[model samples]
Target: MTHAPTPAAMATRKPARTAPAWDRHTWEEALLAATLPHHGARLLGWGLAHLAPTSGQFRAGTSRDAGYLGQALRLSAKQLHMGFSQLERAGLLARAGAAATDGPRHVLAQAFTLTLPSATAAARTESDG
Candidate 1:
């Protein structure tokens, strides 16, 4: 016969699991510092924070939707747009969207992809030199 766990034993159980914190690579931080505006940097940070711990991709409902991201980051729509534009111009972000086909009213809906530089180039340079 099996016995039930005691209250003391249950109390000693491990705590609930949580997602690990996101850490920026040194190259990524340097790129952001050199190219992006302050607001753009903040937006990038928020995006990184919302990304999946293992995949480093933004979660659904947060991908490519500026309005949703703006609300989550507590920034205004205009600020979000500006930040997006800056990030895009810096070669750090890629966005794709289709024009609204229904009505004359245009809807801004797009998806973002973060581009990270690979370390292979640096390694190759070191080997050559």
Candidate 2:
């Protein structure tokens, strides 16, 4: 049987700190320098920046399409959904229901938009002619 790679082995190839505490110490400063609020807001900003392509009130996934975002983000669909909710509460995303299905209207999965400062600038640069 193949042995699993240990944390030390993983760190040899990837040196960046992903732990929230370490990221807060590093990226938090840079993020705060750009926008208001501190680490929590910064994490939300970063999440929004990453999720911009999917931000909107449109449908994200249907019952049959629950894994839609997983294919896009290469993350588990549940993780993607959780991240989306967090981003939404942070004002980085806006969502609503689609047209009625059978009984009452079914809520759309979600759409993505970038309202954060860094993300807004990045969106402009990419979208501009």
Clashes of each: 1, 8
The candidate maximizing lDDT is 1
Estimate every model's Cα lDDT from 0 to 1.
0.49, 0.41
What candidate 1 gets wrong by more than 4 Å, as runs, is 1-31, 38-41, 52-65, 97-108, 117-129
Which ten-residue region of model 1 has the weakest summed lDDT?
99-108
Cα lDDT tens digits, model 1, 9-86, are 999999899964434464357354443445555564556435434444443345445555556667666666555555
List runs of model 2 lying over 4 Å from the truth.
Answer: 1-66, 97-114, 117-129
Q: Write the per-residue lDDT of candidate 2 for residues 63-129, one digit (tens) a residue.
A: 4243443454355544545554444444344555332233212223444333333556434433431
Clashes by residue pair, model 2: 54-111, 54-112, 55-111, 55-112, 55-113, 56-111, 56-112, 60-110
**Angstrom error at residue 70, model 2:** 0.3
| Cα lDDT, model 1, residue 30 | 37
